[model samples]
Target chain A: FATMAPSSSPVHLLFRQLFEKESSTYTYLLADLAHPDKPAVLVDPVDQTVDRDLNLVKQLGLKLIYAMNTHVHADHITGTGLIKKQMPNVRSLISRASCAKADIFVDPGEKIHVGNLLLEVRPTPGHTAGCVTYVTGEGEGQPYPRMAFTGDALLIRGCGRTDFQGGDAHELYKSVHTQIFSLPRETLLYPAHDYKGQTVTTVGEEILHNPRLSKDEESFNTIMENLGLAYPKMFDVAVPANMVCGIQDSHA
Target chain B: FATMAPSSSPVHLLFRQLFEKESSTYTYLLADLAHPDKPAVLVDPVDQTVDRDLNLVKQLGLKLIYAMNTHVHADHITGTGLIKKQMPNVRSLISRASCAKADIFVDPGEKIHVGNLLLEVRPTPGHTAGCVTYVTGEGEGQPYPRMAFTGDALLIRGCGRTDFQGGDAHELYKSVHTQIFSLPRETLLYPAHDYKGQTVTTVGEEILHNPRLSKDEESFNTIMENLGLAYPKMFDVAVPANMVCGIQDSHA
Candidate 1:
């Protein structure tokens, strides 16, 4: 019912389809060609699975302007380097707080401009110390940012675990309460991974019903303790792989 | 409630825990001192995760003997090489018909002596091409297989996807109906991974009531289609990794 909005610009905004691979890591490409350059952004791409992303970019005839990672991933390899390797002109960006070295370290309050769209970086460090959410739209006095890219910080029915490196449950609580849940009810929520079948959700819906973050602190701690998820086997490999913009060194 | 068994040998059995850094692949070591001079058999070993496996073997005061892979994995990297590296005296054994290359190939009807136990290899290639289940018990006339390492062929309340390489619904039908179902119903089913809060199941229970495999062919196809799982991202990496016994050239 909320998918009734028409593009504000007559040039048309085309969002190439985005989805997760077998590992449940979500990747997205957003583009608007109304302006001169027709810039686009690739979000949370997975390593070695860049063929689809590249193919989509070519089919859409859009210029790759920015490649961004929401945070370091635990389950799969990141594709930040692969994109930059294929598209040399695109800038690779990640949060400054993230321990991984990046070409462009983004500040929490910094604004990134691509074509006419503006992405406001909101440091939401609960799932990990460097976790961030990209709010898309006009930073001030505009209803444009209709969506947010929430990496491991949030999910449709749950939130990211705070047991990994630099992960803190308390920080996650603050992030959801202050930064993410503060968004407008109509804002669309797009996460980096969704193990469940559903892909997207609304800010209002998540704020009111997210199983982990919406509950009291006691319940939240209990949930975290009871998760019992085995440490991802690839964590050691994936963390370092993502540190340098998702590049897999031929030699480990 | 089915974990009742009686044994006469004073053999000390040790289990070593090896974790895959990618896709959380877990390899285990089960050894018995009764056959100290002979080689021990490794189960579901991953490529890079063998340090702990070897360390545990030495710490338990046993010698390395053999390596075994339950099936070609689609999730984590394999560790067959690491085992060989640590103990060159150890011979790697896998299903003879499996796509993997091994030092020693085992047939379905063949049985290997491990300490006081007899290990029987059962060709249950439904989860992947050459997938096999290992049944271990003491003595030749044992009434039941004390333990069954089912790999991905049979999971509690679920079955492996019949969509990947060598994954065939019809083949899975036969594997479940004729091969695995014929085993003693009381045999313990030990799967490779379990994410749904389940750790174990029995052969009798699965054969009698598994919702997916127990259904007729038409219903099974519809269920597989509707499940709509994407192909694993690690399929390419995992296949190649498992091919040479989970070893990738450091420079690969």
Candidate 2:
């Protein structure tokens, strides 16, 4: 539907996509207009990029309110715990189903408030039991939120595997078809990790071209079973640290 | 003259070059074939690459005995502290002139013994107050040492900046010429960091091709002063952490 956006829209929302190349992770910063100091959320902040992220926040004159994650990561340590130390008031949030402790436990069908913006959280588990999709704005309403932070549940042309942690192919397949594909065909998808330099994909494009998920149930499950994915290099350190929201030690 | 390297050369040292792309830093691992389990020294291990360094040691089935740094680094945290934790027997080493704390403080003209392999330490300051060049071999003649680990004092074709942390252009010029260049013309030079992919350079090549240091003191100082280099991103965290051998906290 967005064949051509308005020449300019003051209410379009502030968004920035930052890349931490070490782990191929993308961190997103979002804020509503009219309040430069209040950025509603940050998604998937990596540990090594904490300084970079903090500098970006300062550069944009944002008071970061939420340092959140879609799920516990396995490739790199999360910056959630560290960000809290810097932004003391910013809540570190993760899905309660993850059972990975955080300052705030969010669940499906919840609304996260940031200034005039509202992120509707939808549980899109399958990559991990706690994976989530954060949708910005109201799809059919006056606000017209068209973007979705799909975490690791869905990528540009491929979906995350069901091999590590509590990943399940059946749950993942059902989740994508139900919660994600049900969104308006125009909704934009932003995945957590993209090694291939792909940035964004529209719901319509993914529905028509997503090879893994666009197939039948048996074919999708079989494909997930045979991906033969390699465990991440820093899994030993990343998972445990991410469980506590990126705290490397007990003192944190 | 390596016209034909011997099939069974006991005196030959096994060398591997590892790159940590985050900081464009290169860490070298050297092990003498005579006593593989005795002493293997690692140069410039980055904190994030600790696991990688240790894994390389294990993969080669060699025992690590020393973690050495030519000078305190500014770009990335050193893995010396973390390496000590993993390889309890590995001694942390640095130039005594550095005044930086380490398990072993080496001095100029001293010999760092690794089985039959002898690494002669030569004071090569100026990039930092306590930089040193380690020339592997030639303590007892036969199998002449032709390699010098010049650290940041002498890069492939350019020397390090003399702007921060007690860097001196004049001192660096003299040090490179006297301590590093004075080595055998065939001496192989290994640097601490390389932004480009170029790895090893011979002293003979550097003398002719080094753009920054192959000139008189007045011209060298003038060029150094006008380079206008940027401060490293991890300067604060890295310098302090490296001083303490990459220890981020009490737990480390």
The interface root-mean-square deviations, each candidate in sequence, come to: 18.1, 15.4
* Model 2 TM-score relative to the real fold: 0.50
For all candidates in order, the CA lDDT equals 0.72, 0.80
Q: What tens-digit string does per-residue lDDT give for candidate 1 at A1-252?
A: 134332334333444324544677668787766655677888888775687677657755689887899998887887777787778887788999997877888998898776656678999997999999998764432334377899989887688988987998888888877888898876778888765434566677676667788898888888887898888888888888888776565343
Model 2 per-residue lDDT at B229: 80
> Native contacts recovered, in order, as a fraction for each?
0.00, 0.00
Query: For each model, chain A TM-score?
Result: 0.90, 0.91
Minimum summed lDDT over a 10-residue window in model 1 chain A is located at A1-10
Could you tell me how far off, in angstroms, the CA of residue A43 lies in candidate 1 after the best superposition?
0.3
Q: Give candidate 2 misplaced runs (Cα > 4 Å).
A: A1-252, B1-10, B36-38, B139-145
- Each model's TM-score, in the order given? 0.48, 0.50
Residue A89, model 1, lDDT: 87
